[model samples]
Target: MTLIRSLAAALLLACALPASADIFKCTDPISGKVTYTNTKIGEKGCTLLSKDQNVSAVPANGAKKPAASPTDFPKVDNSTQRARDNDRRKILETELASEERALESAKKELAEQESMRSGGERNFSRVQERVKPFQDQVELHERNVEAIRAEIAKLR
Candidate 1:
């Protein structure tokens, strides 16, 4: 008797709730623009779409899987791939070495500039003026070194 009463109460509650209608999409014929709303579209030549039926559910992972690579994609043989990797590594190493040398030179230049005052004026501006070029050079070389290192890291 209690189960029968529970079923009757559930049915009454379901009937009492308001029904939510599907979305309606209306498009402008000339401009090819679309508008979506839950209310029925009064415009002629509009499309009526069911939100629950048309929308696809995403997987539990919360990301769509990537499409597989095409079979006709160009591929190099193992020996050719190895040679390409070797060439890339060698180029990156050479650039890294060059950047290292430049960095050392920049540091030395900055140090030399720091050790001397260019003029008799004891103003802060004078000191800044003398040090700015060396500071800029050091910063440039530092950036170059970091970039070369990053490129080397990317090499296979």
Candidate 2:
């Protein structure tokens, strides 16, 4: 059953590749596991699966060169581009300031929740459950602040 599966795999692999490849079936002497490959093995257990004459071609480098910009492409004026960059920086700075304020508010709210004690929440797990939402809110705001600061930094 395993030999049939190995032969099926070899046939599928041979079909997938170009007809030039000479498929080989090899069996491990120690493990008795059957394997198939295109490359010829020096071991005694390897046998040629395909009898047709093999003529393999080495493929050339496939990396593509970048295309040149067309002559008719729209060009932005330096002053206009500078104005756009300045507007973007101002927007990002405003967002960063807003996020910082939210982060501070979240921290304060989290602190308030942490300071409050409840008679019903006697267990430590109950206390943790009560504070979890506040903690999540604080974490979310902190992440937002960091992301906003990163965006502001990228403007430079």
Candidate 3:
């Protein structure tokens, strides 16, 4: 009889509670990106945000358009603009060439490090640490070269 009464009381308490959905927060281990969803739980990097709380979604407002330029705004002539563009292109090209040379130097240094066999460094981690800076330099220069080329291409 007591067990039946306890079950009835539990049921009543459950019914009295407000119905609120659960929110889960998930984070990517590699990218460190965070995402929130309603249905994920107990998975890797997924944690229950709140069981009793409710989250509301609101649409973002549209972007405001830019105001028109003033009538007295100064404008460059076509030939002047063209000359400026040519100068910009030349600068970008020079930067791209420099970056390419730096990248090649980094690659050569990394190759030399890899080829050298150090008797004291048997561990793979130590080798990786030694080569990491060279690798990073190569990657940085490569990205810079790519960006300079892109800017040059965008020139009129």
Query: Each model's C-alpha lDDT?
Result: 0.77, 0.79, 0.80
Ten-residue stretch with the least lDDT total in model 2? 55-64
Off by over 4 Å in 3: 1-67
lDDT of 3: 0.80
Write candidate 3's Cα lDDT for 97-126 as tens digits: 888988999999999998886997899889
Better of 1 and 2 by lDDT: 2
When 2 and 3 are scored with lDDT, the better candidate is 3
TM-scores of the candidates in the order shown: 0.54, 0.56, 0.58
- Across residues 1-156, which tens digit of lDDT does each residue of candidate 2 receive? 346879986786577644567778899888898877677766688999886546443233655357598999998998999899899999878888888888889889889988988899889899899899999988998887887777667764
Better of 2 and 3 by TM-score: 3
- Candidate 2 at residue 153, lDDT? 75
TM-score, predicted candidate 2 vs. hidden true structure: 0.56
List, residue by residue over 47-71, the lDDT tens digit for candidate 1.
7787544332335467746768899
RMSD of each: 20.8, 12.8, 21.1
Best by lDDT: 3
